[model samples]
Each structure stands twice: as C-alpha cells, then as structure tokens.
Target: MFRLFGFDVRVQSGFVVFMVLIVALYGSEFGWWLAGAIAVLTLLHELGHAFAARSAGADAEISLGFLAGYASYRPTRPISRARQAWISFAGPFVHISVSVAVLLAMGVNPLSRDSFDDSPASFAIWWAGPAIGLMNLIPVLPLDGGHIVNTALDRVLPGRADKPMIYFSIAATAGGAIWMFLNGYQGFGIFIAFLIIAQLQLLNATKPRPSPASPWELAGRALDADKPAKARRLLTAALSHPQPIPPTSNLSMTPARANELIDLLPDPYPHGDAGNEYVLANLLMMTGRFDAAAHYAAGSFDRHPNTLSATIVARAAAALGDHSTAIGWLRSGADAGTSDSGLAMTIDRAPELTGVRHHPDVIAIRRSLATPG
Candidate 1:
C-alpha cells in the first residue's frame, strides 16, 4: 500500500524496486530536486487517466513505475472504440500539455528562462515530458500507443486489432532499436531490445492452448450429458459451427471427442473455449432468448466465474424475471471479490441488487471492481 496525492496506490515488488532504482540513479546523476520533479510529472500524467476514468464513472487505481505510470480503471460500460482511443491518448495529452506550458513559460518569463538554462532540473523536465509522452505513444503492445492503435483498429477492422497491434509493436521496437544504435544511443538501444523481448515473452505467455475437439463434438457431448434441456441448448448454440456440420453418430463421444468437436467449430474465440462460452452467452442475451442465455450464463459462471461472466449471468437472471437468482449470483460475485472496474460497474448497474449498494460487502466488492481494464 502506498499513498500519493491523497489517493492510495498499490505497487508490486518488482515495480517498487524499479522505481527505487530510477529515483536513485536520477537523483545521483542530477539532484533530488530533479528526481522529485520527474516523480511529480509521472504522477500527474497518470492522474490524467484516473480523472478521466472517474469522470466516466469508472473505478481507478494508479501504478507508478521508474519511468512510467498508469491509471487503471474499471470499464463498467461498453466503451466504444473512439472512447477507448481517447482514454489511451489521455495520459500523454496531459504530459504534452504540461510540456508546452513549461516551454512557453520559459520563453516568456526571465525567471523561468534561468531555470531552463544549464540546470539538470530544467533539462529533465524539458526532455522527460516529451520523451515520456512520445514513448508511450509508440504503437507497441502493452503501451498506451498500442492501446490507441488497438482501439482504432477495432473500430475499422473489428477482430483484427490485437494481432496488428502486436505486429506493429514488434516492428516498431525493432526499428527503434536499430535507429538508437545508429544514433549512438547504445543504452537506449539495449532498453528497446529488452522491451521487445519482454513483449515477445508476454505474447507467448498469452498464446491459446491447442484444443483437441471441434465445437460440434463438444456440442454432442453436452447433449449426451444428463444436463437440463436449457443447458444443452445453450451449449449447442455455443459449440455449433458457424457453418452447418454434417450430422453423424460415427464421431467419437469421449471427452477427447468433445475436444475434437471444439476443433471443428470455425473461428473460435481467441481466448479459446472459455471465451467461446462468453460469446455464446452474450449472443443468446442479445437475441432475447432469456432461458438459453441463463443456461449458458450459468455455465460460464460455473466454469469461469470471473467478474465479466458472473455479471452477465446476474443480469440475464434478472432479465428472466428471476430476481432472487440474480441477487444470489450477484451476492456470490460480491463474495468472490474480483478486482476489475468494468465488472464492478456491471454488477453495480445490475437491477436486481440495487438494495445492496451501500452494504459493506457490496462496497468492498465495488472497491475491488474499481481496477482498470
């Protein structure tokens, strides 16, 4: 736990160490004043995001790093691509505004001019602001620019955002590294290479596991199970191929067979089977097939009761005129205590559980849910 600008912040161990190293090195090379200034600037940059998120009625948390900061907010509502793009651009917007203001002051005022001269503090502020802003604007995965690119691509191409953002990050990082090396910025070059490597590892880490069954096979298995009819229907909708599969009893019927069925499903969700359930549940809800929606939503909750799925189930149950069931599911979510602002917003907006808004458990649930997406 940490505190900055009257707000509580949390820092991971690695992040704490990174911040300490940055402060120590900068303070040693320049002075405590310069280090402190940079810290303040970083905080302000992140605060811009926090402010924007809060304005959007989202829960926000700030995380500070050695050379970076982020304001994470829960995305309770469906944010359009343009909104997402603006949110991504907001932090740099603040930094750039400050930079321009400072530069102008220095030019206009004699006192400010002296500060901008040979002093390390002036130099750090002048360079760091633009540098940090531009760095974050780089179209790479895990950066603000990457997010902007993702949002833009999402608007134009829909499903193609993530891959392109990743590819762009890789290409840009590589190009930046080469440019840095040629410009005699060996330290910067090494840093860029390290960043690219880290991003590569992240990409590999998030890669989906290969599935054994096709969707149709999984649907058949679900049908064979002694589940409720509604559950079977939901599962069938979820597991069905976009294109019709030829009906046949000769297909294998084991769990392995179910795996084969999923493999046959076309254009499966990027997050794999778990994501498939989410898409299926939402699709049912959108179609106003409340019973089927409830079934898949419940299935989603059972298999992966993350905030997103849980909230969906809760809402679906409410919409199905099962207020008790919706409230119960929401209470269960309150107990799970997830930390996603988006989920929190969803839960908060649930019609069935409005009475519990001020309850301690619900409030705590809200706090956890406040974390940015």
Candidate 2:
C-alpha cells in the first residue's frame, strides 16, 4: 500500500490476474493502451469514494481487487445520513463523469482519435465506464447502492430497514436478470441471478441479529468466553442506559464471580461508562496500581456518587498513603447514611495501607465504622 492524498491506496495481488485476463480477452480490439486505461479508470473510481469520505472527516482507504475495487472508510464518530449518501454515490458519479468528459472531448476533436479510429478504445470505454457505473448501482450488501438505500431507509424506518433493503434488492436483482436475458445477454443474466441468490442466502443466515445484542447477553457471553475486557465494555454500556439493568440483581450471575471477572480486565483499560470506570478502579487497585485506581475512582465518583464508587476512591486513596483523603471519603459515605461493612473490611485488609493502619485518622475511621451507621 502507498499513501495518496493522505489515504492508503493498495491493489490486491489478484488484481494482476484480473489485468491479465482483460488483456487476453480484449488486447486485440483495444490494444495495451485500452487495458491500461481500464486499470487507471478503475483506480480513479475507488479514489472517488476515498475523496468524499475524507471530505466528511472519515479515514479512508482505496483498494482495487480482481474484477472490482472499493473504498473503505471509518468515521471518527457517527455520520449523518446525508453525508453517508454522498460518500456512497461518489464513486459511480466520478466514473460516469470522467467517461462523459473523455467522450465529449473526443467528439469535439476528431484528430485526437486519428491514430486508431478502429482501435477498441470505444468498446473499452463503454465497458469500463458506463457498464461499471451501472453494475455498482445494483442494490446489494457491500455495494454502494445498498449503503445509499439503507441510509435513506434509516430516516423512514428508524431501526427496521434491513428487511426492506433485502426484499427490494431481491426484487430488483430478479427483474434485472430477466431484462438481461430478454435482451440476449444470457451469460450476464445468469451471473446476476447467481449473485442475487448468494446475497439472499447471506440474508437468511444473519436474519436473527436484526438489532444490536442485549447488554446482558453480550456481557455474559464475553465472560463465558473469558474475554474480560469485552464483558467490561458491555457491563459499562448497560450501566449507561437511562434505566440500566442492574448487573448483579437482574442477571443470574454471582456477585463474587462477577467482581472476580472485573478483576481480570487488563491494565490501561479503555475508559467507558461510569460503572466500567468503577470496575476499572477496582481492577487497578487489585493490581497494586494505586495512583491510577485513585484517579479512575475519583472520576467515577464525580460522575455518579454511590456507595461503591466512594469506597473505591477511599480505598485507593488509603493505599496511596493519603490517610486524610481516605478517612474523609468514609466519613462522607457515613454522613450520607451509605456505609457498608464489606467496604470497611476490604479497606482494613488492604496490604498497601499497612503503613498508615495505625495512624490517628485511620484509628478514628476504624472506630467510626465499628460504631455502625
């Protein structure tokens, strides 16, 4: 891959075979010049998508493969339907535009074609130009038209657009194949029919996942698979819901095991929802990363003050030798009538707090917890 216009542009290994096949089939009619033109124009078609995607603040890459090319894009954040539509349409739009411009210039200056009036340039132009433009407009998944249709339907159906897009594509593909057969393009018609059937099979295979997975199911599956980071992400997302599903109470998971799963999350964890922040704080604390744990706990506490979050901040503070801050957090929790004996016990046994366990403030905290709420 090589960078072009701040985007990676690469041609797949199979593209060499594609060029060889094209040369073998049409080299006599259009000669080597026409073959080179097809390759260049196809690259330009993919570049159109890259250009439009970048214009919309997305990281874009262009790739040319056997028989086709595509532009891959990843936006920094969610993009609007209008921008998506533009990006999807740009490739065909550029292909057709370039073809028309070249055709028009040739028409005005007949001398431009004096060298080879009988060359296959005309045939190559039609095939690589308008033909390719029309083929990509077919409404199928992984195609530009499919993207356009899906985005447009999102505004109308909101969340249930997949079924409609699949149905419409099937109908369109069937009609297109029939028209091709009737027009004596039997070979192309059969190819289109086969493509349509494959797409339909894929739709059937993935029909069950009509929407995103539920947080509990995803989290549970992650835990089962021993992917603690993924589970942590889902749990955090669950907690962010307007009415979060209580992980401990709503799910059939044991609290001890769940906490242990949280401890398995790797260090430098990706920051996420408040609940995940609290979990990360606990993980860091367990790993003897007192400073980072205190930072995360404090941030989580600032966002959503709760008994658990307060205890984390307090425990992390105590581990870091901040006796006053640690005692103050427990005092605040007690003042709010939110003290938990489990939290006090956990803090009292923390190995990092051994140095300050006999401090005056620590003694008072122990006395205060012993006195009860």
Candidate 3:
C-alpha cells in the first residue's frame, strides 16, 4: 500500500519500498513542505497524462509507484498518429509546463532564490520539479520520452520499433554511465550501471529467441526465386499454424530487413505474417481504419502471440472503443512474459483498469521488458 495525492494507492512491493526509503531518508532534510511539493509535482506530471487522455475521451487512473508516479489511460477510440504523438508527449509537456510556471513565479517574487546551498527547501522546489521533468524526458524504456520515440518510430518505420529503441537506449545509458564516471559521481555511476544491467537483461529476454526460418521467411525466399507455388504453400502453412521457428541456417539479413523483404512479396499473406501484419495494422491505424487494423491484429495474434502482436491488438481494441478488450489483451500478454517496457509503461500510465494495473504479472513483465535488449 502507498499514499499519494491524499489517496491510498497500491503499488508493487519493489517500488513501494523504494519510495518509502526515499521518503524516510530525505523527507526530514527536505522538510514536509518541500517533500509534499515534490510529491505534488510527480502527481501533476501523471495528471498531465490523465487530462490528455480524458480530453481524448479515455479513462485514466493516477497512482504512486516505487520511486515515482504514473497515470494509466486507454483511449475510447482510435486516435490519429498525431493525436497519439500528442498523448505520448503530454506527460512531459505537463512537467515542463509546471517547471515553467515555477520559474515564472520565482522570477516575479522579489525574495525567490535558486541556490540550494543557501536554503535546501528553496532548492528542492526550484530543482526538484525540473529534475523530475528532465528525468521523465530521458529516452529510456518505461519513460515518457521513450514512449514518444517508440510511437514515433512505429509511425515512421511501422514494422520495426524495437531495434531502434533498444539501440538508442543502450547508447544513452552507456553515455550516461560514462558521464557519471567522468564527473566523479561514484554513486550515480553505480546506479547507472544497475540500470544498464537491468535494461540489458530485459533486452536479452524479450529478444525473439532464435528460431528456424519462419514460413514468412521461407515464402520470401521462394518469392525471390520466383517459385510462386512454394511461396503459396509456405504462406498457407504460416496461416494455418504459426509455430516458433526452429533453430536453422542463419539468414543473411537482419530480421527487420528480412521482414521488409517479405513485405515486398507479390502475394504476401494479408494478416498471418507477424511483421507484415504489424506494419499493416499500424498503417491502417494511422489512416483511421481502426476496424481493419483490429481485424489484422486479431489475425496476427492468432498466428503469433508475442509482444508486437499483443500491442497491436491492444492498441487496435482501444481504437475500436473497447478499453476493456484492450486492457484484457495487454494484461494477458504481460502475464505471458511479453516484457516490452513500452507496453508496460503504457499500462502503468492507465490505472482505472485496476484489475489489469494491479496484477502482479504486469510489473514483472514490464521490468523484464525494460531490461536492456
């Protein structure tokens, strides 16, 4: 059990204890007033998401977490890519707005000061808000900025958002670690190392386990050789019973490139191919074909019930005005160990769906997803 915004909130044991420790040690030094101010800022950051989601006619819930706080919301209907982008950016936007407001207020006050050495309380007010805002903006998994990047990448690249996001996270984390080391911040460096290790573990776990050539890949190879009948047979097999590819000969291309090649096939399976299905669904969703995207996502899940397919299905369901369905699928995938931090972060931000949000599996999967891949 946790408390925030004068509300009793339930959070995972890990985060609940972490927040408790933070409050215990720092609460006195910062003073109750300053500590409460920090809490309010965190809540407001989440509320930014809540308000934006509400504006889109979505349902949202705000909650406290281990070290921070979040809002969970699912849109009542499919929204435009632009709208999605806005929603993704809204949390940070709120944080920044609050920071700006504080700065403006400070500027207007004759006695307002910025030096932490002078008064820890004033320093807490001045820096805590912006620091929290900036931290949320970090483009790492489970962060608001990470969501912005992932959604944008989905919009731009369609079939492959994971690789870029993972790669970017690695680079950013590594760089942060290096900066901390160089600055002689041993404690911070250790913390960053832990974060890196966590992220890496997540990356390895969520990585598509190596498998034999998927039917889609076989179909692509056949199409490349102009073997139409063989291609059709493979596509049929994929549609009928999509199994994890068995370990086989290495493909010359990266998975993303292979997926692109598969997408180029003249008579590709409409929804059975996971990669193609994801791309198609996102395209449809982007174009406001919520029903069509939902259909394709269902087909994708039927073929391969992994993180990507689950996300598509959930998003599609949300677009189709079925928040319950969306939450169900999201929770199911999370339970099945589909640890995609971006997906978990999405769930973390929407808490009104308490059954799903409070499920122990949800945080486990999310933590797994955030581990570096």
TM-score of each: 0.51, 0.54, 0.48
Which is the better candidate, 2 or 3, if ranked by lDDT?
2
What is the C-alpha local distance difference test score of each model? 0.64, 0.70, 0.64
Summing lDDT over every window of 10 consecutive residues in candidate 3, give the lowest-scoring window: 108-117
List residue ranges in candidate 3 displaced over 4 A.
Answer: 1-16, 23-28, 31-34, 99-117, 187-198, 201-205, 208-373
lDDT digits (tens) for residues 130-203 of candidate 1: 66677778778777888887887887788766766677788888888888889888868545865787679767
Ranked by TM-score from best down, the candidates are 2, 1, 3
Best by lDDT: 2
What lDDT is reached at residue 28 by model 1? 65
> Candidate 2 on 64-125: residue-level lDDT in tens?
88766879999987888999899999998998778757755656222254522444675567
Of candidate 1, the 10-residue stretch with the lowest lDDT total is 241-250
For 140-217, candidate 3 gives per-residue lDDT tens digits of 866677777788888878968867787788888888888878888776654476557756875787677754565656
